[model samples]
Target: MACNKSFSSNYFLLTPEEVGFFDLIHILFSTTKFEEGIKFLDMSKFVSKPLSELGSGIEVALNLIPSNRNVFVFMLNFLRGRAVKPDKTSATFLSFIGLIDKRVELDGSIKHGDANYHAALSAMASKASYENSACIETIVKNHWKMKFLGFYDFWNDYQGKATTQAFLLRDKTCDQDTIVVAFRGTEPFDADAWCTDFDFSWYELYGAGKIHGGFMKALGLHKNDGWPKEEVKQDGKPPRPRAYYAIRDMLNKLLRQNDESRYIVTGHSFGGALAILFPAILAMHDEAWLLERLQGVYTFGQPRVGDEKFGEFMEKQLKEHRVPYFRIVYGNDMVPRLPFDDNALMYKHFGTCLYYNRHYEVKVVEEEPYRNYFSSLGAIPKMINAFWELIRSFTISYAKGPGYKEGWLLRIFRIIGLVIPGAPAHSTQDYVNATRLGSSDVFVPPKDI
Candidate 1:
């Protein structure tokens, strides 16, 4: 496959730029760019939350999703629903998937370049899952308790409030003291966009261009004055405009007040990619070359970073130490599982890899990834959605709302949810007029971008 003119099969697939990743030095030092490098560093890609004029545009998802059940189902469905690209080595196991002729009906359009969109509409609907499920299972299969920390929940802290990132010390009896922090993606669900604790302008220094004026204003740092406005480069080219200092600051904060001890990194989807870079920045800071002390790195839904050579070098570096710094994807999940080989998306030079972690496993949670694709469509038919979607003003809103009940009602509602179908109980929305949610609004996902 190396330097072969014949691509494995697909053409657009070969675009090196398409293979975005987090396994680098500034981006992949294994401790800085990706905080989860040490353990399961679950981040909702915290720092990447869109800082828009209208605020973080999280409402697009809200308007589409009417109830709690739908939201919950959507999250669960999409979490493990990435289509797998067929490979020569493991094609035999695919064995005419039992669910092959069964495709889910879509009430709307599948995202172009979006696998979930393809899975819901394409013939291979039942085959997709998160690329990292098996890898995540292996790392925690033997654990006494698995703690799930939603990366979005850190919004308060990110907004300058407080966080549970270092809450591990609270649990004295917990074994190994390993934690997994999870974050949400842009599709289907809009993760929380509370920019509280961190310096707004500093975070923007990491972003491209003058998009973040509020951030600039907050830090008394201007885009032209301090931050460099450079087009985001996906190749091996370094991000020069944005300084890694913001990321470096977060790392310093994470390990600052605590007695750093046993830790590892883990994340799902985007968080998985961030895991590599978070640690990398930290490694650079450690005068002692602390990167070598890492126990392992296990991320599900991990994406490729940089060119193949970079991925190789990361693998080689980690493998030499018997550490599990490998990106593990399930056989079926199609989140662009890169060639973990030397010519990989990240760590291209050298990497030690074990194809499948024994403990890694996939539990087919759903017969179909999005069974209720029809219901979510509301009135839109699958075929006609193309034109209608454009006409409709795509609105997204996220907020704290009243519950169905305060006492017995909450319990009754919970019970009814089991008996009858439901939507999301918890939700967030955007107010078109205001940059904040309701009157106490602070931030929102960008309307554009």
Candidate 2:
């Protein structure tokens, strides 16, 4: 009933054919004819098809079916089939329907003013520190109704030495189920994490601007997955970055296991950068359902990863899919501003920024033409500042490195009251603290910084 009201309000946004397709999906699901639904979709039509073509097909489907409340109700039942536990195929069909529902809501003109969404996201970001399995289990079991499905500890190295982690969570109690893949941020005093941060060489991606070579390699994308030569070359493109490939594999496996669940990808700092990247790569997949199921990406203090070209490409892709990327910034967190914004260097940030200033107030920055002021500075001054920042980053990295005798870096900072302006503003705790202050304390950004 609520969805119907929402859909009715935004009916203008939906073409006749889209409405028809929604009706068709609802009928097929209500009658338990999922196989026919899949056949009607015709996966071949999606592969290699651009968004316009895919959209056209949806239009045709809508034209053929009668749009009504039954369609919406059936679609909701399919998405919230918590009691049914449908087979994988049925699940996939239902998930596709669920994705369509989400896309409709997201693309609609209604304002998403729910504070609970932001609060829940902040809570998730706060959980980034639970790297140990037991701690993760405790948090999931005690704090929310969600179940801890599993944790993935992946290596950026080929030999499986240096590792980064992500965990999966599922909530089945709600009307619409959800699956979250949350990546952990840099450990307070771990050298390996710092090493991953420092290794920022630019690496070229096919059809996208150059990304941080270190992060790319750290995700193990350059390495082969032992697929047969022909299988590996099936896409006719060069090998995808190892991290992207690995994440895709894991996500595909999870989706199969939990077919009706919507996905939310998130992380903090280094992990936040990966969260932004994971969805960008996922958008390239031939499976239309995968992109549809993506709910949102929320990151805290993510660094600039690619150049302007990459940013442009991602902005277009994400906008087309009606996906929202919230890059939450706390104070003057330096990570969001780095790898240097120099156009010549090719590093840029994608998505709308929700900036929280020192007073823990918030403001939303829509995407615009970005100019890297650092590159615009006087030659001598720019060089001096760059050199100084480089040294400072290294020193901070080493202090946070595994070799540091300190138990944890954040604890040390708290004890000493050591608060620097930039990177220190980059912590997940700071983000959580700011968000806890609530929307009533929201701050508008001053016209002049």
Best by lDDT: 2
Candidate 2: stretches off by over 4 Å: 1-115, 122-126, 158-162, 224-247, 256-260, 366-419, 440-449
Query: For residues 61-119, what per-residue lDDT tens digits would candidate 2 score against the true structure?
Result: 43222222256654665578622332322212212112111110111111124443533
Worst 10 residues of 1 by lDDT: 426-435
List residue ranges in candidate 1 displaced over 4 A.
1-175, 179-260, 283-293, 319-322, 338-449
198 Cα displacement, candidate 1 (Å): 26
- Model 1 Cα shift for residue 425 (angstroms): 25
**What CA root-mean-square deviation does each model show from the true structure?**
22.0, 23.4
- Number of clashing residue pairs, candidate 1: 105
Best TM-score goes to which candidate?
A: 2
Q: What shift in Å separates residue 56 of candidate 2 from its native position after superposition?
A: 57
